[model samples]
Target: MNFDFIRRDINAQKAKSQYRQLVCNSAASKGKEIVINGKNYVNFSSNDYLGLNNHLEINKALQEGADKFGVCASSSSLVTGYHYAHQALEDDICQWLNKPKCLLFSSGFSANLALFQALGKSEQSHFYLDKLSHASMIDGAYHSKAIVKRFQHNNIEHLTELLNRSGKYSTGFSNKLVASEGVFSMDGCQAKVVELAQLAKSEQAWLYLDDAHSIGVIGKEGQGSNYFADIDITMATMGKAIGTSGAFLTCSEELYEYLVNFSRHYIYSTAISPAIAWATKKSIELIKKEHWRREKICELSVLFTKLLAENVELVTTESSIHAIIIGDEKKALNVSEQLKKQGIWLTAIRPPTVANNSSRLRVTICASHNDKDIRCLAECINKAIT
Candidate 1:
């Protein structure tokens, strides 16, 4: 059969306001600028909150790693690809998070999938998650064989209700796992990690937090929400904060061993380049020593929020990610385009990326951005809004 139905559906999406298109970014220069569609734009859509991606030292470290280990590992970690660099990086992550053990994954997405599929599957197990958790976490729950229940976003009471009810089903399953994003990617708000941890403890459930945005972007010394929340199973990605590739999970030695032996994603995927691990080691050092990066991000976040609040309708955020709440998807897209016309680049985030009726322009601030960058962004957004 011809796939004209698919084509017609796509065209109907454009007519009904759901079609999507990708814009290619040709080049990116540091200090808050990116080139797209042959034009320069002030970038406010990147996740490099600490500005580590363009750090000269990080570049040097990556180069050194490459010189030592080349671009690719010969096999998977379960095979012979596990190198000294990989071991060192894993050690550093465990030390940083104060976890007894850590296991590396090819990506944060895979790590989430593997964790749920491997740990949350049981006739006696149930998976509970925040309604607004990351896509990976949601997908993991879908892939899991356990019963899945999503509580209201950041609603601790609702979560507690779920935990209490889960006990009634103990005849069917003996395990419960709670998953959430430490820092929500769209709204930039943090989960009540401590509260969740305590609830999980009282209910005898396992708590899993994905710290993709928070690690290297929040917490003391960038230890992530786990330090503040005292969580046991925490996943962090190196690509965002460490300015490298891959992801890892920090947990007790028992869980670590279980994942190594049972997590299919970890066992099946090709090992990341060992050089990336070496660069991760250096990144961990910078995350510790470069205390000023954290301070600078906090200051810039406040400045941007303050300036935007004076004009655009926006939410106040403690983290580097901020949102200008524009309700309709088409309206958000038009506003994003208007800002882009002024050489300011911000993505118009739409549902299903976020909840329907909550579409907005997501603004991500980075340490590399200066006051001028924030001021220009504020001015451009003001013009776009008006």
Candidate 2:
């Protein structure tokens, strides 16, 4: 394999101001603050929407789990790795989401890949996805044997039209799955879950939602899209507002059994840490019981929107993420840099993570953020953009 193309591509990315790099945090981040390069900044780039990252109860549960179940699962779930902790966690999730069964994976990406690939087993499998669906969903759908169609972002009419057109081709053996993100990661806007559920029912199709961004932020009890509609299959990550690690998919008992027997990702990969699963149960408990966290995020988000300058173009959303569109890749990077200098850690989101020339500042407002944090961030963003 030639390494020259890799170098060329990287150089091209740098030239276009699209090169990516990782920055390590020096310490465990607290509510709304992260230490990077020996300086603390208000962290508007985190997905810890409910601010439960370092909570005492969660930590205690983790410790207890480690002592009880050990840190590692030691092998794949089918290979005697699944523990009591995992079972308990799955049960907790099923109960919380009001689903018949739940399956856990090491990460949201893996969970998505598993679900899509498992469902897309044959040429008769048809998947209709949102154009703005996450990369994992796209990869899984395209890589599988399924015939995949993408409707315009959150365009129900387009989705309905596609489903109608494809209705004639449906057969008893064919599987039709309509997939979307509950809260779009980049745009931070919600999908029409209720409408999608209705369409799926009318079309005799299955609905799959990746609620990675919505699980701990939406709904009265953080049940996400599940609170609004009865989705066929729902996946959410524990890393975000749940403030742990791993991901889960909630589905019917039949689908759960099928995935367990056939899903390559789930069958081959090791299960998530039982310790984390135990901790995640505790996290979800807090997410359910403490409505104040969700309320705080809403309050802070409103304050942020109100404080933003008149000229700043922001994607209005009820979720934790807020995208400020900055068209040029270079301009977005510069704006991010300006905010960094002002002691606000906001990331510049650019293509191909987003569409070409749709570069943005993807600000995540967690419950930990206060009125002061929102105000300061808005003021800094206004200054930087202006």
Candidate 3:
């Protein structure tokens, strides 16, 4: 096949200021600093919301897990790869979320694909997703056989209308799933968890929450969306605040067994490293006991909002993410460069990752960040944008 179209597409992206390139970080430490090209900068683009990355206790647990269960699982969970570490991690998640059972995956993407694809087995399966849902959730929902509809972001009235429409035409589908992110990744705004849960119950639909961004940052014990409502199913990743690797889906025992038997992603792929699973248990333990970390994020976030200039607009969110909207893609990149020059590493979020003309500086405030860091960041951002 001719590859000229690939070059054309690349050129088009560059022309539109939408081209993306990977930057190598020589080192990342304490979830608040990264070394790129031998220059260290305060990291404000990380998803480590609770600032648990490279934590001492979690690191020690990882080493102990390796010593006890070895580093790798060597095979898929359906095979001989299911180990004590994996089972223990699953149990920990189930207990933390107060769910009947939990199943582990290599990442949040795989977990989402597994859940949607498994449940969306027939034409009767309908999925209503939030407009700002993560890419993984969108991909999984579209890839499934289910009829998918997207509602306005955080708009329960819109979702209710869509659900009513789906009910009017529903005849063959076995189930209806309503999927949303507990905390939107790009905007950092939260979904209406309580309202969605109530709507799902009233409509007799299954509520699925992708709590990847909320898990380690919300609730008194970091229970995330589960703290707001009794969601039917929830998925969260360990790579963020949990300071480990892998993802997990918490659900009813029947759903767990069904995924084990029928979810191709789970059945075909090798299990996550046993060592990481063991480390995750320790991470959750720390998350539960360390209320100070959550408080730190809140305190820092408030400081950041207070420090910004009057003209600068920020998306209000209780989560660690804060979006400073800069409509033009090129302008957003320029502002990002200016922040970098001032020793802050904030990324420009552009089209496709967000809506058209909604380019922004996606700022992540971690617990590791001090008041000084927030003040400096805010000053730099205010000066750069203005």
> What is the C-alpha local distance difference test score of each model?
0.85, 0.93, 0.92
Residue 226 lDDT in candidate 3: 99
Full ranking by lDDT: 2, 3, 1
Put down candidate 2 lDDT per residue, 101-170, tens digits, no spaces. Answer: 9999999999999999998888999999999999999999999999999999999999999987877666
As a whole number from 0 to 100, the lDDT of residue 294 in candidate 3 is: 96
Regions of candidate 1 where Cα sits further than 4 Å from its true position: 2-5, 309-311
Against the true structure, whose lDDT is highest? Answer: 2
Query: Could you tell me the TM-score of candidate 1?
Result: 0.96
Answer with 1 or 2, whichever has the higher lDDT: 2
Query: Could you give candidate 3's per-residue lDDT for residues 20-131 as a string of tens digits?
Result: 9999999757569998899889999998888888989989999999999999999998999999999998888888889999999999999999999898878788899999
TM-score of each: 0.96, 0.98, 0.98
Q: How far is each candidate from the true structure, as Cα RMSD in Å?
A: 1.6, 1.1, 1.0
**Lowest-scoring 10 consecutive residues by lDDT in candidate 2?**
166-175
